[model samples]
Target: MFSTGQLIFALFFILAFTVVLIVTYRKDKTIHKKNYKGFGWVGLGFTVFVIILFLIKHMLNK
Candidate 1:
């Protein structure tokens, strides 16, 4: 289970990423945001997705 602080940090992390992307796109023309997905993060994202779904199902069952 994730604590409130953990959730808040994750929210802030996403928000900071969005802000950074917007700021970089506006300030620079050729930042080159995306080329290809790196293996680690892609795997991590999928793992996180699965974990979230499992957590949801477990909570619902409870």
Candidate 2:
């Protein structure tokens, strides 16, 4: 039920938000790399832990 003006506003808002996010991330890329080393492994471990938990839950439910 959005009007034409609302749709145009939303489009512009999304584009601007995306552009800002990209610019901000690029600016902080170096700092992020230095500070967040080993972050990927932590994320992987958490993911694996969650999957294992779900498997256990499923097995228990059966």
Candidate 3:
């Protein structure tokens, strides 16, 4: 069982960390958009490949 002070400190730490993370992401949003373009297509392709692999494995096991 944590004390009241420890609980308050934990809450404050989490809130501060979240605020900092949001601010950093907002500051870098433009750079990310410019640099990471087409990454989603790569992710999609990987996901599809994995699904196909699993389906093949399942079919072979039957």
TM of each candidate vs. truth: 0.44, 0.75, 0.65
- TM-score computed on alpha carbons, candidate 3: 0.65
**lDDT by residue for model 1 over 1-62, one digit each (tens)?**
99999999999999999999989877764444354437668889999999999999999998
Q: Each model's C-alpha lDDT?
A: 0.86, 1.00, 0.99
What's the CA error at residue 2 for candidate 1, in Å? 0.8
Between candidates 1 and 3, name the one with more favorable lDDT: 3
RMSD of each: 10.0, 2.1, 3.6
Highest TM-score scorer = 2
* 1-62 per-residue lDDT for model 2 (tens digits): 99999999999999999999999999999999999999999999999999999999999999
Per-residue lDDT of candidate 3, residues 1-62 (tens digit): 99999999999999999999999999999999999999999999999999999999999999
Clashing pairs in 3: none
Model 2 lDDT vs. the true structure? 1.00
Candidates sorted on lDDT, descending: 2, 3, 1
**How many steric clashes between backbone atoms does each model show?**
0, 0, 0
For model 3, give the 10-residue run with minimal summed lDDT: 31-40
Which candidate should be chosen as best, given lDDT against the real structure? 2
lDDT score, candidate 1, position 27: 76
